[model samples]
Target chain A: MLAKPGLLVLGLALGLSTLLPSEAEAHRRWLLPSSTVLAGESDLVTVDAAASNGLFLFDHRPMALDSLVITGPDGAPVDPTILGAGAYRSMFDVPLRAQGTYRIALVSDGVMGSYELNGERHRFRGSGDALPAGATNISSSRSNSRTETFVTLGAPTDTALQPTGSGLEMIPVTHPNDIVAGEPAVMCFLLDGQPAADLEVEFVAGGTRYRDEPGIVMLRTDAEGRVTLQPSEAGMYYLEVSSSQDAANGQPGRRASYTAVLEFLPL
Target chain B: MRVSIAFAFAATGLAAAPSAAQEMAISVEIPRLKVAEYHRPYVAVWIEDAAGKSVRTLDVWYDVDLKPEDGAKWLPDMRTWWRRAGRSMTMPANGVTAPTKAPGTHSRTYRQGSRPLANLPAGSYNLQVEAAREVGGRELVTVPFQWPPKALTSASARGKSELGAVRLTTKR
Candidate 1:
């Protein structure tokens, strides 16, 4: 009977962590960094100042790229070429050195920001395309030198299944954590209601800039599409989910979209 | 029918929740509900719980047929409401199936018993509303609300210009 009690305690512990997953993640925010894109090794990437301001979607209002900086992998400054009226672009040729992961951080000294990228270091989904539920932007005070951005890449979330198969799934949603400290909470995205594997996803946070660098967090989803993190702090958190891998290509954009649910608890 | 049914979605951060709590209840209404945006104002209301943190978009009254696909877009605003109720249910039968609300009094009730409030046992919560108009601005008002079946039976807050007075009452 005593052994059973201990077993019960062990079972309770297991249920708590798995059921709640990670206690509410603190709010995460980052400023969009101006990183230079390399040509060749054509894997598309999308950059945004923040995910929450909704300006990243351009539905709120078009962001002025002129108010931003640009960089390239060759460690040189790059110019913003007018793609459409307000849209701008610079091609990336230098590939991420190896299969190893790197991150593209967005940096801006002013205002809060949120952003995300998918790769091995922070893979949150199951395929090359990720339906990221949320992202985080970090604040930074860097140089104003106009040049090509030098960014390390995070492990991108890879989309493994064709939505045409068992079909695209719905992302999870939760409440808003009004009290926590972070602005952009990394909302977790799970396919089939669990952490998935090997998918490309993106993250967007408050309008703060990461200066084209990935911050301290590098979370990866398990086979169930879940990203559980043990935070060093406690606060409000939100995640935005997007499945559109081609968002970097400016195509239909990321698919399987869901807003991150708010999580508030102690670290 | 390609008419535009304009609406708004917004949130309010009412209060902070305690560390170990369980569940939240949401009730919503609008004294300004009506048919047209310029007229009185059709309103949408809902509950957003923990399991489904997105607005459990409980109720909405606007011209669903205004456009073939108008009502679908506004679903994202009630972040908490959408996840619990809106995301899973079909639009026609969900809380927001109605076409518009009258201008008198309207109210709805919800509970977060048994289930984790969006996976959290208990904590603080906020009530948010977005009031949008055709030629007017959309206003989102939030008031803080707490949890754990407290001694407080009723709470109230004033809505933005688009809405009249707002009040909440709990029952046994």
Candidate 2:
């Protein structure tokens, strides 16, 4: 009984360290699409993505090109043509032809941000990318970004919107493409094909350009792993959901976070 | 464990089941918009919980009283309510359904618990009013109110184009 209390206390202390505000402020890599949904086949979609300490504040630090992975509505890989890259922002375009949800994910390579511990050099990574064999002496971290948005041509089909067992994905019980602004849309989330309950899924009102703390509404899934949300705005509704787990392989002080952004259009 | 689970389910069922005295009174306003192609907007009034689940629908105003009584065809234009509750309902829902109202405040009270509100559980809810018009913009306004209030509680919200000031009040 005494050992259990000690273990619980230690567990909580470790949890608090991971939730420190500074680390969260440091790694905010998001992909902001011009429109999550395209009205037709001829519609073109543009995205502005970067890795910065601020949200939507372009500081010219573009994400590593190799880290990006784009999937079309049919689950086939689609490549986005890079339009321009400046010091603080990178722009890309995906000519949406298929009429289904497209998912863009970024698994960045480790960025070295080192610190000292106990009079010795200690490196702890934020993202879960494993360090190279000889680079264990340096603390390394990588940020993983996963976002899902749809492009509809004629009529939407279920094939592309279905869950592909991505890290953290939401399968809209109501059709994702057919969401109306005022109606409640139910979505079931899966973390590797199993129901994930009690996760805090935040729904932010879209069209608030450059406002960091514009009101955020949060919903938690019930025991059945479902959340119902009414989109308040008529623009691109961005849902930011993330979860973190301790690193495997007996790595004592490593945490790996999996973050997902679902960009929905409520008309 | 089995008994507790069964009891929990039973409790939920009871809380959601409408009792004898519960009542809901809604007041909807239609603002006369001055436009060239002016048409009465099709309005839908419904109640949804914080989770966005439709608990009950109070009223839906469409072109129900058209020349050939063909206004039911355009009921689908009120997309949100049409998808949730409109499709299942038979046209001209007797005492509950009505034609589009003129620019004025209209009040309706469900004396006996209606189909949707009959099984409403006590929780935070939003009174959603959606209006879509022909040749005009669509507007939606939601007013948040609590159920089973200690006393009468009311809330109001305003809409921009197709909708007017929406006021919702509930009495236990």
Candidate 3:
């Protein structure tokens, strides 16, 4: 019953998400919490987020948060103010007042692209125009990234740690807020509440500013839709799962893309 | 206040538990694949508590059938279980660890009040199965189940590439 509050806020937040402006295709957004595991109730936690076109490089502009929903230990919404912003990232801090898990969800609007197929530029977007002889094709619209992270203070509880029931979702088998370094963290990906099988998940070591493309460990879920990753060190870890499907109508090359980013630390 | 309240609810749920004289079985299948290079997947199956601590290891299928038995060297590739319990275990571990399984359904059944089900307290647990191949992909699947069946507890999950369907059935 406690998960209802977070789910309620999430439902409202997702309903509002559709009206926002779409971001660029290459811009992958991520939310990074300052401390994944807080020691006590009075402790404060900060989160820095950005949309990056380059891999693991925070060089792109920070995304405007149309709806920033922070569900706290009791499943009530916790609002956070934008403390600062740079060209590539924005920062916010919140005081931890409860003893359970905290969930930060950022849902942006879907992006639409209509490019004229000049040569070999045929991609997902198409405008239902008749294809000329040896002409380039068009692409339709694509969904923006939905980013989320879990932060725990003092103890772990079943707050918003489960799947959010829409788009790209990560349901933790072993609770994400209570993970330990060197221990295997298990989770499953669900696309619209159903098990997403053979989904490719990219796990990257975090905390690097922007020098090199971080080493990526590629993993695919089993038939039952699960992937396991053991955190090597105690720093930041990024788990990204994304999928794209061709338009069911099978015409102007419409494609729907879904991405979910989860940032946490192994304690 | 919230933590204690939640803990009390969990304890009360466990206290109203059923007897543990039921039969349980785990069915794990390794899917056959066609690739340029194929090797038998080294699988590790274990149970963990809600806190993610390994409670018992059901089976570890490595290179037991090989001549040199050097297959144990690659068990670390099943990184999740190796970090949790495999490192503490000795090689040629009898009764629990076996050889690489072929591409088929393998069922492991423990009788009532066995070493695993007997020691498991009435609580929430996750049965995790991980498989890693030499040149292929690595996959893990978890089946969440509650001990002392809330009602004939049965859960199943499917993997895509390396593993088939994983099912855990408990009969009261």
Candidate 4:
């Protein structure tokens, strides 16, 4: 069983967030893998699904894995194991398998709790990780359409890094070419995509959240979605994105949320 | 490898320091005296477009004399700037300690000095101000200002006693 890593996010944020927040949740549902894990170096593909909560709703419960459904390259359902908690696992260590996309979805009818998402949904992944001979491209996050944010996948040869205008966010790949070895750095955010306006973006890097860095650091997007960040020290970094303004009307809880890509690119 | 890593950090940090040479400032004042029974304004100042769209976040000043629990409870009211820039940040004050200004004069300064603010494009934006006094009231006052990062004269606007006359000065 592959270990599910992000089950603790919501719990950790309880202290500062507003309970019974008036605003509906506008969160990135499933943080997809920006690109398929390289067959040469990586093997297993694990996923964690999160349910949405509308504004002012305070329902924080783990999604029970009552039925885990995964469709392989053949439009056939694959079996996954419920690891006792709010997590699920599947192994892709098969031989030179098929070259197609797979989807891993769940149906829990999510307990009738407090908050609801921007709409009705049970988490779904239209594509799974890739096999060496082929590839499976899935966005690292869903573009919470209600909030107008989009998610994109990355490729080894990606060149949109010079901060291309992609809608409400400008994705700047902060890691340079060769993928920064242990620190591959292509990040996603829900900004205006264009760089003409100074945006307030937040994320964690080298285990450190970059909400307030001194002065500022400039990351220029190259032809590819690749930008380089020479960390002042060798450490883990996470770039968390959120709204830079208050959702005016009735929505109360969420201030903002952006796409965060956890790439272990070592210098 | 470690030495190589050290050199890279040193290089980027040095590079991160933008060439310093521009500045921006604000001087907030209320014209007359309006003595409310007892309450100071929780003020938030930022820049936006004529269409009432927000552009740059300037500052948010709340009660520094609030208890830890009380502060946390009421802090979310500074919604505009918080959403655009504050949520991801941890406030330095555990309790409200900064002195609360009366219905008189107020001012603060911010400088890009020369580190060109990344997202502010060349155009027009409104220098806006909003205030919410505890057990008091809420009012939004705005003053428009143009941009290009060059030295500019003071921009001004006025309102009820809550927010008297607000002025902004920018030097690039």
Best by TM-score: 3
Residue-level lDDT of model 1, residues B35-132, one tens digit each, is 45454344555433443254335455555665543554444233333323444555555434676665555665453331122223344555555554
- lDDT of residue B94 for candidate 3: 68
Colliding residue pairs in candidate 2: A59-A88, A60-A87, A60-A88, A123-A139, A125-A140, A127-A142
Tens digits of per-residue lDDT for model 3, A1-267: 222354335435445433322223345567777656544224567877776644445786565565677888877888787787788888888767766688887764343434454444432222335555555434555453467777766456777666566666777887776566777888887876788899888877765664475667899988777999786775566677776665446343222234444443332
Q: After superposition, how far is residue A248 of candidate 4 from its true place, in Å?
A: 47
- lDDT by residue (B1-172, candidate 4, tens digit) is 5345335545656324342333457888744445556666677677776666665555656654465433433443444444333333344332212445766777776544212143355678787777666676566787777765566678788877568888888765
Q: What is the TM-score of each candidate against the true structure?
A: 0.32, 0.47, 0.48, 0.33
Q: Candidate 3, residues B101-159: lDDT per residue as tens digits?
A: 88999998753445444446767889999998989988889999887565677899988
- Winner by TM-score between candidate 4 and candidate 1: 4
* Tens-digit lDDT string for candidate 4 (A180-224): 344444544434443323434443343213434432344544443
Q: Which stretches of candidate 1 lie over 4 Å from their true place?
A: A1-182, A185-267, B1-42, B48-56, B77-89, B94-96, B109-128, B141-152
Q: Interface RMSD for candidate number 4?
A: 19.2
Best by DockQ: 2
Which segments of model 4 are wrong by more than 4 Å? A1-267, B1-19, B30-36, B49-55, B82-89, B92-99, B113-121, B149-151
Question: How do the residues A83-177 of candidate 1 rate in per-residue lDDT, one tens digit apiece?
Answer: 33233222223234321112222221211112354522231212223335544332211111111112323212112111112112323221122
**Docking quality tier of model 2:** incorrect
Instruction: Give candidate 2 misplaced runs (Cα > 4 Å).
Output: A1-28, A39-41, A51-65, A107-144, A207-213, A247-267, B1-172
lDDT of 2 by residue, A1-267 (tens): 122454335435445322221133334456767655443224457877665544455663664445567777677888888887777777788877665566665543233234444556544444425543444344443333354455443344566566655456677787765677677878887766667778887776644456757657888877766899786655555566665554345443322233443444444
- RMSD (Cα, Å) for all candidates, in order, is 23.1, 15.7, 19.9, 22.3
> Which is the better candidate, 2 or 3, if ranked by DockQ?
2
Chain B TM (all candidates): 0.55, 0.78, 0.83, 0.67
Provide DockQ values for all models, in the order shown. Answer: 0.01, 0.02, 0.02, 0.01
Question: Interface RMSD of the predictions, in order shown?
Answer: 14.8, 10.2, 15.8, 19.2
Error of 3 at A256 (Å): 6.3
